[model samples]
Target: MTGEEGLRACDLTLAGLLHLLLRSSHHSSSKLTIFAAQQAPPAPGSRRQRHPRDAKLSTATPSYIYIPTTITKPSATLPSTDDTDTHYRELDLPSFFNQIPSITMDHRPQAWGRPRDDVYGAYNASYMNPNGPNQATQAPIVTGTSVIAIKFKEGVVIAADNLASYGSLARFTDVKRLRKFADSTVVGFGGDVSDMQFLDRHLQSLDIEESYDLSTDQAPRLNAANLHKYLSKLMYKRRSDFDPLWNHLLVAGLDDAGKPFLAAADLLGTTFTSPSLATGFGSALAQPIMRRYVPDDEAAANLTKEKAIEVIKECMKVLFYRDARSLDSYSIAVVTKDGVDLKENEKLEKQSWKFAERIRGYGTQVV
Candidate 1:
């Protein structure tokens, strides 16, 4: 029943009705009482007759937090009709919306200041079927932006600026969405942060020997390079099937055979391998810089760890200066056949507006 109808039928004020309701239900619950193994029921005529279904339970621990359970969290029910139908019945469970008969709007548009909103559209009811065919998300909602990866001599270094934007909002920074798969694969994510998360969970389920329904050897092991190749294939297959991962991923690591490996996969399921790879704006600005260091088979074969690293750093600085979405601070990860080493907070040195002061147009320098 609506509170007003209940109060008028009982001939009580609002406050009085609420107080009585609380007192009755709170006393009846016996929430804090400690009971022994067996307890006796009161006689049929007794004021507080015990329910036969109630069972004694152990009270090893009691919560002290007082969370309101009545008005604050009440079961849904049919509204009280009028002053004549005043008595309230506590529902054993919430009434299902479908079970309620057709409810017509009353004369009062809205009791409080709430909007009297009505939805008028045909609702498709078959979506809940267990045997329903598979469906994919229509469009990405939350998404990561750019992921850039470069190869060095000792290993591969991949970095992604932590930005999960909602369309143009740039909503979430510090969303470290990049994940390392196994030994050799560091999956750097760009585009659709939620899709990245969904893929993360999906990958977590892939190596079944670790997660579920398996009984055998278990180890602190990952296979990121292998995982990367699989993802490339998966992305392309999904695109072919008319669904896509909606993420641009850069996988940096060594192949199973211990060769330096860096590859990328995109929403269209396109795949490419290089000494360095980037997605989004980085693709245009950073690729040429990386290619200078690892330009061809001859260059990549001769790439020393220090030179490779220097080239990557130079590329990052260029990206920071060029890509509006790029940041001075980023996460860098190195993966080799040995292991994966990731640095979440690496900042650029000497990045300041002091350079602007020395430039031609600080105030009115160009004369």
Candidate 2:
């Protein structure tokens, strides 16, 4: 029909026109059926074929229902809702992901986003304590004991034990407490092993920096005395800030003037220089022995290298029998005008406890 005839046909109302516009815009496969109050019913025994959308209405009455021709089937990649295996497989992905350990802090309790149970629960790692304080290690755990050094005719001799005690128990037996810095200076540490490692790395960085600067013609490099002064200032700064590095350090080498240099700096930043120095328990036990050999600068100037080494070995032997924190294996360094002679894994002569067998009233010993 033409446009004007269709617009005027059957006296169409506003609602009817709106309904026609909506139905016409729908999919082409959908048929529109209209039921009016004035329309007559079909004759008896004459079955009228109904559209699929209108089949649900009662035969004695007239009605209409719109059914879209396009079916919303699930995508080919998506599993059917009725398949239990598909659902199980999809759920297994998360379990697999959770089972995979993460290097980051993502598997924490709050980040897990799942209920706690024995199978998949909170991560319990020794290094991770969720509710604990966020503070660095301020106290020493494993530590080494005394570092003794003395100045003699040729250069300075330094010694320290290889023992690293866990609290009061001698746990690690092979920890070298002596560090050689820049091939000319030997630093003997006598406290917290962690802080010693930190300082060792710092000295390594300094060595690297100095090596890089060797391309230029420098007048003089850092000597043992200069290193001692630098360490004294560093310790003092840390002490003033109430965060001192828990270590007593002995810096021993030849000075810029090629004289035997021996100096000490403690955690309190106290600096002391003499012919002899001893840190930790050695200050009380080994100091006298060292002084007897090199009592003054003049005596140290006259002391021979052989006599100086004999004195240090005697002191170490006494410390091994007397000092509870001392070990038989020690690291000894002799810094001279030639270079540093470091013997890191030096073991003392075989010792015996046979004398203790004669002691009375100890470990069921007969009187």
Q: Per-residue lDDT for 197-315 in model 2, tens only?
A: 88999999998887777776764688899999999999898888877899999999988799999999999899999999999889999999999988899999999888898889888
Query: In TM-score terms, which candidate is top?
Result: 2
Q: What is the C-alpha RMSD of each candidate to the true structure, in Å?
A: 17.8, 19.3
Q: State every prediction's TM-score relative to the real structure.
A: 0.56, 0.61
Candidate 1 whole-model C-alpha lDDT, 0 to 1: 0.60
Model 2 worst lDDT window (10 residues) = 83-92
Judge candidate 2 at residue 352 and give its lDDT. 65
Q: What are the runs in model 2 whose C-alpha is more than 4 Å off?
A: 1-137, 350-367
Clashing pairs in 2: none
lDDT of 1 by residue, 163-206 (tens): 67677666776888678664446788888776788788887677
Alpha-carbon lDDT, every model: 0.60, 0.73
Clashes of 2: 0
